[model samples]
Target chain A: MEKIEVIFYIEALSNEKKLLERAIEATVESLKGEKSIEVKDISVGDILEDEEEELLKYSGVIEARIVGSFRDVALAALRYSPAVVEVLRPGKMEISARELMEILGDVAVFMANLMEKFGGLAIYPKLDDLPEPKIGYSRDEIEAMIVEDRQILYRFVAEVYDKDEETARVNMAKALSYEGCRINKLTVQKAPNDDKKLLLAAEVLSDFETLFQLMAKYVPVALSIIEPEVIDVTAGELQNALTDISGFAQELITRPLKKQLMDRANTTFRLNP
Target chain B: MREALYWEPLEGGKVRCKLCPLNCIISEGKRGSCRVRKNIGGKLYTLNYGKVSAIGADPVEKKPLFHFWPGSCALSISSVGCNMHCRHCQNWEISQADESFPYLHDMTPEMVVAIAKRYGCESIAYTYNEPVIWYEFVLDTAKLARKEGIYNLLITNGYINEEPFRELAPYIDAMNIDIKAFSDEFYMKIARVPSAEPSRRTAVIAKKDFGIHVELTYLIIPTLNDSEEEIRAFARWVVEELGDDTPVHFSRFFPHYQLTHLPPTPLETIEMAYRVAREEGLKFVYIGNVPGHPGENTYCPRCGKPLIVRWGFKITEYNITDDGRCKYCGEMIPIAGKHAKKRYGAEWW
Candidate 1:
């Protein structure tokens, strides 16, 4: 009978209590389900409660010893456990816990083995109180959302007649009525090479027709300085909406969307350098 | 979240949602594609139920019901979620937003009725967002509003299945359905739907089966579905399927949402489309979004007179008599509404 030992570190968010419990249970369950490995007692110990401990410390410990056929056995079995499985929460909020078996499989016992060789030994089953999100979308529901349309800030360049910020503001208002749009942020910058030129950046939300109608009235050049980036559209235009719309089009780049593009093209070729 | 209207249990703690044509078989803890319907613990739940995203008072004419209670106002309400991802969606924000978005206002069906009565709104319109997706909310509100003698109107994309829509029929009084485009290709690619036939069927059922007042609006996006053939076909279909007096609104499509790169529907194209619709044996074809245009007025087809004068949402004159007959020719206008005569009697006009 061959015996194998594996260890790894896992850190959860500053919160999430139930998460720690399920992670530990799932880890233990995986080893229990392995048919080839004759189970020995699974030891989950070591409360990392040193009075002065702060960051980079252990929270708990999980150790299991079992006679197995493969070099690394029980951990590989846990990967297929249906109940204590790791699942993504679909969209932006999906965060996964670091399963000890999966992590130890990839990262290996480097730190623990190194520390053990030097006479220091400590380990914690790192997890916190983050809640697990259960997402159960059927085939039809997923397809509907996938086929749904998304919106992003549509940026278009228009030659402007005014350079001053006040006139630029007026030009925007004159072009698109404030009835539909709300300007959330505005930044002012000077043209890199030419101090005589000024750039006006304002984040405004309106319909595509109204936004372009107003923007086209003002020129997009720095000297002409009429820029209204789409900060957010009114709620009327958000049904079946995509949360992130920045990828919809690449033609007109807004300030926050890609501020790096605002730099002067010839700045890299400055004669002074 | 409210329990959804139509869904069945699937294997492995999943549920198959039968709300719209997108029969989403949702796994446990996952949501259907609408973002409002979630599969929680093997049960389908509608998240947008009673969660009002946008609500306000709009003139019934704004609903463009043209025939249904023409001059009255409706307390329009909507929650988030739509069946299609139309590139030119005008009200995409609330319609496309998830149920958790901060702006959603919580209200019950009873409360909606109270608001309409308080505001003197003759009807309550489930609008702005696609009303079909908010079925539970609309069903509750529509039933309550009907009992209160307040009309219930659904301004929707009309992308709904027969059973759910028919279930809503008894309570819904009128609906302003957006036809989008007459072609299946437009519905498949631009509107992101399997086909346009189902949507057309919803309109038919709304009027014929349920006897609900129905009006259709076709957004004329330039260089897309604004061809004369589509407009003529749509007009012909209305006459054949619904009727000649169906009141088809040829609304000018401005570059909106994803279709912003294109220009606002050209006036020439709208004029041509309007002419084509009228020539195709359709009565009551109206042009919208281009304010103060002569097409905004409702003219008597028999008398050849401007029967109802309007200046963009404002009714300047109504020449229909107390009996729903045209003043000049005494021709029945096929109009169904609470006329001024109902309030002021014979001496009003």
Candidate 2:
């Protein structure tokens, strides 16, 4: 296992010494067998001494450090530790990629709740540098690993689109285009064709107007793909990619055209059958 | 109708109102977002050209500007319309409506100058509304006021674009710009504007670029934005970006306008905010709106002696020298204009 070192800069020691000690104990317990932890300094030390005197005068030099395994499990455990929690209180606790996905899942559920309470305009999401999930991953894996972890992306969309569902849907659709997926229909229809391949194909058929309207209704789920600039593809590349999804291409092509007939059938039968 | 100030015609029947941030691109018979400037037949016309809706002889300290003119009465005048629609606006009646409102008083620029001179006021404040929205009127009055040896003051939201702000900077002697909150969320939700970051940028520009005496006021509303961390971040930004010498006023927010359901900000919250700002190395942090509070007085950052004693808008005692130095400690304070007993009027808190 590769060794990864983490640092925690603690401040105002005199006011919260007992709390700090408890946090350190919790951190030690959490990191047991995972990696090594050390208390480097208790007093102010030079972090940026050579910089301007004014800058140095404001920030008191006291920082902490924690060393652990670079593996996803160890890193996640270290980040979610109580000591880390106490130190980074009021700010989002930073964690490894795997842990980030878990947090993102929690965030997605939170976004759903926020949307229900305040309406669609309250979801904003952001994503940083992270690899795209494998193309053949299941919907569960995609939702858990890639879709759920990006918080900033959701927060951004929530703030921008707020209550305006169409814009939010459009943004989400645009985001989905990165994963070669398109959200063609956001209905309760869950048939055998309602899988990742079909969903991805459905997304390709989406236009900006339709996507925007969808985003407005649903709370924006902030998901970042492997690439930041996904909209820069040529028209030829867009068409070729959609055609590549061979298994669901025919079904995806007729999905939009079949929506009217499905609605008409339900209305004619009164759903009594 | 008088000729307007700060405008130039464009090529294709468009007149750019170079007054504020909106830079209103006017089509014939259409008005800008401010509702003051209109494009009439390819020419820009200011509707609130000289319409004074509110006029008062208020204590200079009441402008909530402690460093400028210390304690004096300024003849304040304002026209209707604002570039931004802040939800917690205290003066929305004057700021939100157009000049066509029933309360508007028809006073020309010259008449405004005359009224200030008649009231024996040392300065004229273009306040009670966003002065930038009434650009032509403010510019004209400022010109006349400057020529007459009277100072021009502005209590503005500081949301104007750079060009217009620079154009108006020369005339404005002192300003108290409201830095509503540090975050973009607060700006969007509370101010209903795109960027509050611009206001901070403008403050630095006002102080460094234009050399205008600038002070900042932040209303501490409970639950919404009255946190120590937020206030500390704000103070640190001000001290770092604007400078430690820049006086920051942490004003108490009372339930008003659209945000009335929430109770008035507690006095302790204001005090805590003041403490946070002070702890963040801000030299001068004062509390406003809550009268008789100790934070209202200006004290020497080094010696801790009261430099300018104030009660509400009244100056009970003045100990600073002519050069704005403390009498006891001899430390220089960052105040503008000359010191005179006549300027410091007697007003009970």
For each candidate, what TM-score against the reference? 0.58, 0.54
The TM-score, computed over Cα atoms with residue i paired to residue i, of candidate 1 is 0.58
The Cα RMSD of model 2 versus the native structure comes to: 20.8
The most accurate candidate by lDDT is 1
Q: What lDDT is reached at residue A14 by model 1?
A: 14
lDDT accuracy of residue B77 in candidate 2? 89
Candidate 2: give the TM-score of chain A: 0.25
DockQ metric, candidate 2: 0.01
Off by over 4 Å in 2: A1-273, B1-18, B24-27, B342-349
> Which fraction of the native contacts appears in each prediction?
0.00, 0.00
In candidate 1, stretches whose alpha carbon ends up further than 4 angstroms from where it belongs are A1-273, B340-349
lDDT of 1 by residue, A1-273 (tens): 223322222222112345555666776786678676565666765344434333223355555554442223323422321111111112222111122213222212322232233322111111121112222335454334223311112222222234765555444432322212333344445545764555556544333223322322232332211222212323222111211111111112222323332343324342321
Evaluate every candidate with DockQ and list the scores.
Answer: 0.02, 0.01
